[model samples]
Target chain A: MFKRKLFHNAYGKTLPYLLLIPTFAVIILFIYWPAVSSFRMSLYKVSPFGNKTIYTGLSNFENLFKNPDYEKSAWFTLFYVSFTVIATIFLSFILALLLNQKVPGSRFYRTLIFSPYAVSPAISGTLWSFLLNPVVGHVNYFFMKAFNVQVLWLTTKPYALYALLFSSIWKALPFSIIFYIAALQNVSDELLESATIEGAGTLRKIWKIQFPLVSPITFYLVIMNIISSMFQSFAIIDVMTKGGPGGYTTTMMYRLFLDAFAYQKTGPASAQSVVMFLLMAGVTIVYFLFGERKVHYA
Target chain B: MMRRYKKPLVLAAEFVLLTAISLFFILPILWIVASALRPSGPLYTYANPLTLQTFFPTTVTFDNFVHIFKNLHFGRALLNSLLVAVATIAISVLICSMAGFGLAKFAFRGKNLFFFIVLITFMVPFESIVIPLFVLVKRLNIDNTYFALILPAAGNGLAIFLFRQFFSEVPTEILEAARIDGASWIRIFRKIILPLSIPAIVTVIVMVFMFQWNSLFWPLIATHSSRFEVVQVAITAHRSTEDTSWANLFSSAIAGSLPPVILFFFLQKYFVRGISGTGLKG
Candidate 1:
C-alpha cells in the first residue's frame, strides 16, 4: 500500500510538468527565441539573402532616427492610434448608451452592428474601398451631388489616411459596442431607479451613475483600442492604400514591412521591430500603472 | 399628459439616430454585395454608381464569382485557407486544452510561474516578432509549408488561459472520485473532463479558427508562391495585380468573408460567451 501510494504521488507530481512541456516548448521556440533573435539581428547589418551578416552595433538604430521616412511613419502611427482609439471608443459609447435605452428593434439593431465584428479587417478595407472609390464611390457621388466637391478618397494625402481611419474605426466599433452593451446591461437598475426618483435628467443620470459604473470596461477598452490601432491596423492600411499617397498613411508597422520586404533592409527592419516592441511595452506599463487602479470591480 | 407625449418624442428621436447609425454600418456591406452583382464597366458608365441601383443591383449574376474561381485561382486559395485554419485549430486546441487541464487539476511547483509566462506571452504581439519568426521558419526550411502557418499559431496563450479558466471551474470532487475508482488521469480527462467541457472546447475552437482564418501578416510573410496563398493573402495579391477585374475582386472579398461571417451567425452565442469569459472588458 505504501509503495502504491508513493507511485501515485510521484505520477501526480510529474504530470503537470509533463503536460506543460509542449506549451513551454512552443513559447520558447516561437516567442522568446524569436524575441532574442530579433534583438540580436537588430545589431547586425544583414545581407540580401539574410545569410551573410556584419556587426553594425547601434548604427541601424541610429540610421532609422536619421531617416526622414521613419520619423514620418512614427508620427503617422501616433496620429492614427490617437484618432482611431478616441473616435472608436466615443462612437461606440454613444451607440451603446442609445442601444441600452429600450429602443424599438434593439435586438435587430444589435445584431446588425455586431455583425461587422465577424468581418476581417482586410475585407472591411475592401468594402470601404468600394464605398470610397475615387471615381465611382457612393460617398464621392454624394459629395459631388450635394456639395459639388470631388474628393479623392484613396489616392490623396490626408484623405487616404482618413479613409484608413474610417475603416479602422468602423471595424473597431463592434468589440467596444459589445463590451459597452454588456457593461450597461450589468449596471443595476435599482441604482438608476433611485437616480430617476431624485429627478435626474437622462443625460445626467447616465453621466453620473451609469458612466462611472461602466468606467472599468471603458478603461479596459481604451488600452485595447490603443494597442489594436497601433499594431493590428496594419491590415486596413495594407488593403486600403498600401501606405500610399507618398507614404502619408504609413504607420510604423507598415513601414517595417516596407523596409524588410520592399527594400530588403533586414537589420533596420529588425531594429524597427525592437522599437515597436518597446513602444508596446511602454503602453502596457502605462496601462498597468494608470489604468488598472481606475478599474472598478463589480 | 406631458409625460405621455414626451416619451414618444424621445423614442422617435432614438429611432432616427439608431437607423442612421445602423445604415452607416450596414450600407457598405450592402454595397459590396451590390457591386459584386452589378455588371462591370468603366466607372459610372456601367450603372448609376450612387443611386439605389448600385446599392441594390437591378440585374444580379454570379459571373464575378465564376471569374474569381476560374481565372483568379481563389478556389485553391480558399482550400489552402481551410487546410491552414483546420490544422491550426486541431493542434492548438489539443495542446492548449491539455495544458489547461493539467494546470487546473494538478499541483506542483512552478505552476503559477508557468501561467504567468503564458500571460506574458499573450501580451506580446506577433508584429513585433515577425522578422525573427520569419527567419526561424526559413532556417527550419518550413517557410511556405503548412507547418509554417500551423506551427507559429499553434501554441496560443489566450486559448490556454481560457481553457484553464474553464477547467478550473470543473469540480475537483469529480476528479477525486474518478481517481478513487482507479481511473488514470488521462482516462479521467478524456472520459469526464472533456465531455463535460464541450461548450468551452467549442468556444475555443471557433475563436482559434476565426483567428487563423482571418490571419494576414504572418501568412503574407510565410508563403511566397501561389501554391500556399491563403484567402486573405490571395485577396491582397489579387488587388495588387494591374487589370485585375474590380468585380472579381469584390466577389472574392465577399467570398473570403463568408466563412467567418456565417460561422459567426451560427456561433454568435459562443463568441459572446468567449469574449466575456476571456475578460475582454476587464
Candidate 2:
C-alpha cells in the first residue's frame, strides 16, 4: 500500500473513492440490491395490485413445486440449457476447426459465420420463424421432396420445442465460434507440426492438441452459454413459439416472464428467480471453485 | 507438413465442408434481406418451391422499409434504441473506466472487498434478477423511462473488469511524472490517461453498444409504452399471433440488425478483443 503515496500529493486521498462512487451506486442500486431483494421478495406474499405484502415464508416455493407446469418448465429448461449450450459449443468448435484450416477466403468465411452474433435473439426468431414456417418452410419442403412427408414446424408440439432448440443453437453459435477460433489460433504451429511429425492425423490433432489447448475457453463458453440460454431463450420463445403447442417451449425463464408479466404472480416468479439464481450462480461458483483450477493452461 | 499432408481429395472435401457451413450461417440472413427488399406480398410467396425467387425478390422494392418507417413508427423505435445505446455507452464508459482506474492505479482499504463485489456482479448474469430489478426500478419511479433501460446496464461489471485489466498495464511512471509536473488528478485522468485508453474505450463502446442495441428482455420489461419502445420490441411487435405482418417484420428485423453487423465488420478485431476481454483469453 506504500505505492499509494506516489501520486497521492496531487490526487488527494478521496479521489479514488470518489471515482468509484458512481459504479458502486449503480451496482448497488441495480444489481446486488435487486439480487438480495429477490430472495426476500420470494418469501413474502405479494399482491398483484402492488398494494399488499405478507411475510409468508416458503409458500411461494411450495406453490412452484406443486404446479405441474412449473415442473415441465424445469424439465424443458434442463433440456434447453444442456442442448443449446452443448450443441452450440460443440458445433462451433468444429466450425472453428474448419475456419482454422486457413482455407481460401477464410476471412470472408469467418465474417459471414459470425454475422449472426449481431442479430438479436428476437430478430433471430423472426428470421428462423420465416425459415421454418409450417407450409412454406424450405426445411419442410426439402423434407417433403426427400421423404414425401409434410412436417409441421412451428405449429406442432415437440416440433416447436425443436424449433426453439434449433434457432437458439443457431443464434448462440457465432459467439462460441468466435471465441473458439480465437482459442484455436493460440495453438502453436510448432506443436501441431510436431504432432504431425509424430504421425498424428487430422481428427487426432483436433481431439488431442487443439481441443485440450482450448479447454479453458470451452469451460468459459460452457458457463456463459448456460447463463445465456436461460435468458436468450426468452426472446425466441416470445416470438417464435410464445411457449405454445401446450407450452412445450416454455423454459423456467419464459415461465417466470409469463408469471410475472402476464399473470402477475410476482411472488412465485420471485421464487422462480431465486431458484434459477441459485442454480445458475451455483454453476458459476462451481466454475470458480474447480473449473478454474483444473482448466488453467499455459 | 500439416498443410502438405492433405490430399487433393481431402482439401476438396474440406473446401466443400466450409462452403456448406458458410451457407448454413448465411442463408437465414440472406433470406431476411431478400424478403425485406421485396414489395409486400403473401408472407410465404417466395419462401417455398425452393426456387431462385426464394433467394431473390422478383420486384425489389424499398416499400417495406418505407412502410414501417412511414406507418409503424419504427423510426421512433430506432431512435429509442440509438438514444439508449449512446446513453449507456457514455455512462458505462465513464463509471466503469473510473472504477477501473481506481482499482488499477490505487491501493486502498477495502480494495479487495470492492473488487470482489465488482467480480460478483458480473459473474451473476443481469437477466436473473429482472423480476426484482423491476420492483426496485418501479419503486424508484423510473421503470418506464430510458433510465430504467440504460442505467442498469451502465453498471456493467465486464466493462469495468476490462478497463481495470487494461489500466493495470499502463506505466505508473507516466502518471507519477504527470503528478510531479503539477497536473491535478482530473487533468491527469483526462489529459494523460484518457488518450492512452483509446483502445479500452473503443472496446467498451463496442461492448456496451452491442449489448444495448441487441437487448430485448430488459427493455421489454423495464419500459412499457410505445414511446419507449426499442428496436427489438418494435421488430417483435410485428409477430403477433394474429395476422402477422411479415413484410414489416422482415424489414424491421433487417434494419435493426444492421448497426451491430456493420460495427462488427468495421471493428472486427476489437470485436474479438471484446470477446476475449471478458476475462478469458486463449
Candidate 3:
C-alpha cells in the first residue's frame, strides 16, 4: 500500500510536465530554434546549397540599408501599415457601433460584415486584382465611363500601393469589427443608460462613454493590424502586384521573401527577418506601455 | 417638440448611412461571386461595368470552375489543402488540449514559468522565423511534404493559451469528485473533461482549421510540386498561367475562397465565440 501511495504521488508530480512535453517540444524545435537560427544566419553569408557560410557580421544589414529599393520598400511598408490600420479600425469601429445599436437586420449586417474574415489573403488579392486589372477591371471600366480617366491602378506607383492598402483593409476590417462588437457587448449598459438619461446625444454617448470603455479592444486591434499588415499580407502583395509594377508595393516582409527565394540570398533575408522581428517587438512594447497608462486612466 | 422631431430624423439618417456603408462592404464581394459565374467573354461584351450585370450576371456558367478543376489540377490542390488542415487541426487540438489540462488542473513546479513561456511564444509572430523554418524543414527532409505544412503550425501557443483559459474555468469540484471515486487522471479527463469541453474543442478546431486552410506563404515555398500544392498557392500558379482570362482567375479565386467561407456559414457561431474568447479583455 505504501509503495502504491508513493507511485501515485510520483505520477501526480510528473503528469503535468509529461503533458507539457509535446507542446514545448514543438514550440522549442520549430519556433524558438528557428528564431535563434535566423538571428545566427543573419551574421553570416550562407550559400544557397548550405555547404558554404561566410561569417560577415553586419555587412548584410549594411547592404540592406544601402540598397535604394530597400529604402522605398521600408517606407512603403510603414505607409501601408498606417493607412490600413487606421482605416480598418475607424471603419470597423463605426460598423461595430451600428451593430451594437441592434439596428434592423443586425444579424444580416453581422453575417455580411464578418464574411471577409474567412477570405484567404491570397484569394482577397486575387479578387481585388480581378476587380482592378487595368484592361478588364470593372472599376477601371467605371472610371473610364464616368470620368474619362484611364488610371493604371495596379501598374503605377502609389496606385498599386493604394490598391494593396484597400484590399488589406477590406480583409482586416471584419476581424476588427467582430472584435469591437464583442468588446462593446461587455461594456456595462447602465453607464450608457445614465448617459442617455443625462441627455448625451448619440455621438457624445459613443465618443465619450463607449469609446473609452472599448479602448482595450482598440489597442489590441492596433497591435494586430500592424503585425498583420506588416507580415501576413505577403500573399496579397505576391498575388496582386508580385511586389509591383516597379517595386512600389514591396513591403519589408515581401522584400524578405524575394531576397530569400527569388534572389536566393538566405543570409540577407535572415538579416531582414531580424530587423522586422525587432521592429514588430518594439512597436508592440511601445503600444503596451501606452495602453497600460491609458487603461489606468480609464 | 423640436427634440422629438429631431430624434426620428437623426435615426433615419443613421439608418440610411449604415445601409449605404454595409452596401459598400457587401457589393465588392458580391461582384467577385457574380464575375466568377460570368461567361468566358470580354467585360465589354457584357453590359456596362456600372450596371447590375457587374454584380449580377445576366448569363452565367460554371465553365471557369470546370476548366480549373479539370485542367489545372485544382481538385488535387483542394484535396491537399483539406488533408493539411484536417491533420493540423487534429494534431494541434490534441497537443494543446493536453497541455491546457495540465496547466489548468495540475499544480507543479515550474507551472507558472511554463505558462509564461507559452505567453511569450504567443507574441513571437510566425513571420520572423519563417525563413529559417524553411531551412529547418529542408534539414529534416520534410520539405514539400504535408509534414512540412503540418508540423510547424501544429503546436500553436495561442491555441494552447486559449484551451488553458477554457480548462481553468471547468469546476475543480468535478475533478475532485472523480478523484474520490478512484478514477485515474487520464480516465477522468477522457470521461468527464473531454465531454464537457466540447465548446473549447470546437473553438480550437475552427481556429486551427481556418488558419491552415487560409495559410499561403509557407505553403507557396514549401511545396514546389503541384502534387503537394494547396489551394491558395495553386490559385496563384493557375493565375500566372491563365493570366489573360479574368473569368478563370475569378473562378479559381472563388474556388479557393469558397471552402472557408462555407465553413464560416455553418460554424459562424463558434467562430464568433472563439474569436471573442481570444480577443483582448479589459
Correct interface contacts retained, every candidate: 0.43, 0.58, 0.49
Two-way TM-score contest, 1 vs 2, winner: 2
| Angstrom error at residue B65, model 3 | 2.9
DockQ of each: 0.43, 0.52, 0.45
Question: Which number leads on lDDT?
Answer: 2
Residue A274 in candidate 2 has what lDDT? 82
> All models: lDDT?
0.79, 0.82, 0.79
| RMSD to truth, every model | 4.9, 3.5, 5.1
Q: Which digits, one per residue and each the tens of the lDDT, describe model 1 over residues A1-298?
A: 0111111244557788888888778888999888888778899998887489999899999999999999988988888899899898888989999888776699889888887777778878777886787677778888888899988999997799888888899899988897788778877778787777779988898788887777767876787798788778888887789999988889998988788778978889889888987787777767766765665343
Cα-based RMSD of candidate 2: 3.5
User: If you score just chain A, what TM-score does every candidate get?
Assistant: 0.91, 0.90, 0.90
Off by over 4 Å in 3: A1-11, A47-50, A66-71, A145-147, A288-298, B1-11, B70-73, B101-113, B119-128, B168-183, B187-200
Each candidate structure's count of clashing pairs: 0, 0, 0
Q: Write the per-residue lDDT of candidate 3 for residues B76-140, one digit (tens) a residue.
A: 98899999999999899889999988877776788788986776565565766877788899999
TM per candidate comes to 0.87, 0.89, 0.87
Q: Residue A221 in model 3: shift from native, Å? A: 2.5
Model 3 in CAPRI terms: which quality?
Answer: acceptable
Tens digits of per-residue lDDT, candidate 3, A198-246, equal 8999899889988887887788688778877887898788878888887
The predicted structure with the larger lDDT, 1 or 2, is 2
